[model samples]
Target: MTSVKSSAKAFVSEGALSEIVVKIMDDSVVEFLVGLGFVAVPGKEKETLSLIAPNQEFKVEVFSRLRDEGICFSVGPDWCPAEVFEFLRDQKKLTGFYRKIVWEGTSTPKIIENC
Candidate 1:
């Protein structure tokens, strides 16, 4: 049997690392998601916030895209509560992508931003 540490090392060496940590300034991503009309789930201790999908279609699309990108995420049917559809329908915010600068560097980077 393989040791757990060896297994983890092999996983990392295979470029199959399953998780990533992103540091966003000022919890802006959470704020943006909330501002976009996503309902925030409570009781998180980290800077990250759990958001509920407004409907089944939205949840399916998000999960599909994330799976296609090979990103790991967690979810359950409860993520789309019964009242979420009505809540989303009444929201004034539009559903779409909006780019926000989450990080800034004091010096120039070796890699080009476009790249």
Candidate 2:
């Protein structure tokens, strides 16, 4: 008999925000959030997220609802109304910013730097 190791796959809903718990050594969370129009501002032992959503109403609603939640939401620019990649580039902080680019007939997605 042979023993095989299996791992669970992570999936994110299309056009929706995916929440995740951050680890102490995890620094990529901030970059991921920035791509989704939510910039992570440093806080006391935590991060305060500023969302650039579709409209003021949406921003207010989301911020108010998730203000106390200690979760990082992953979102892509296609699902968001803000040009997060451009914003990061313009701000000269595109060091870790990445974008998912899919090629023709390729089922797998490639993560490329947003420079």
Candidate 3:
């Protein structure tokens, strides 16, 4: 696994409740995923996107910011199963990391100012 220092990619879906993918360019750190919402793994060509694909690391970031209440529902039926969120709050990935959520909500999407 790459050093956390090297884990810099981040992204965000463009539509309302759209997916958020982040790529941390080696060019910068604090500017990568900082306050941008979440970080996602780099796409094949750097910007490629996969719908309903969540970045395990990004979810960890959300947990840190969100209340222990946790997300009331799974990110997506396909990307996230009930078992996942059930373990999200008190459970940590066996790989010693957090799961990222890159899926859209169960509804139509338009745009969000902050997303």
Candidate with top TM-score is 1
- Kindly list the per-residue Cα lDDT of model 2 for residues 1-115, writing each as its tens digit: 2222221121122223332223222344455445545544356242444544565345434432322222222234474312433443356543232332322354443323232
Q: Between candidates 1 and 3, name the one with more favorable lDDT.
A: 3
Kindly state the number of residue pairs that clash in model 1.
0
Candidate 1 residues 1-115, lDDT tens each?
A: 2111100000000111222222222343444434434333244433443434455555544433322322222111332221232233346322322111111346321211110
All candidates: CA RMSD in angstroms? Answer: 16.2, 13.4, 12.9
TM-score of predicted structure 3: 0.24
lDDT of 2 at 16: 30
Residue 5 accuracy (lDDT) in model 1: 14
Query: What are the lDDT figures for the candidates, one per model?
Result: 0.27, 0.34, 0.33
Better of 1 and 2 by TM-score: 1
The 10-residue segment of model 2 with minimum total lDDT is 4-13
Query: Model 3: how far is 110 from its true place, Å?
Result: 24
For residue 91, model 2's alpha carbon misses the true position, in angstroms, by 3.8
lDDT of 2: 0.34
Tell me the lDDT of model 3 at 66. 27
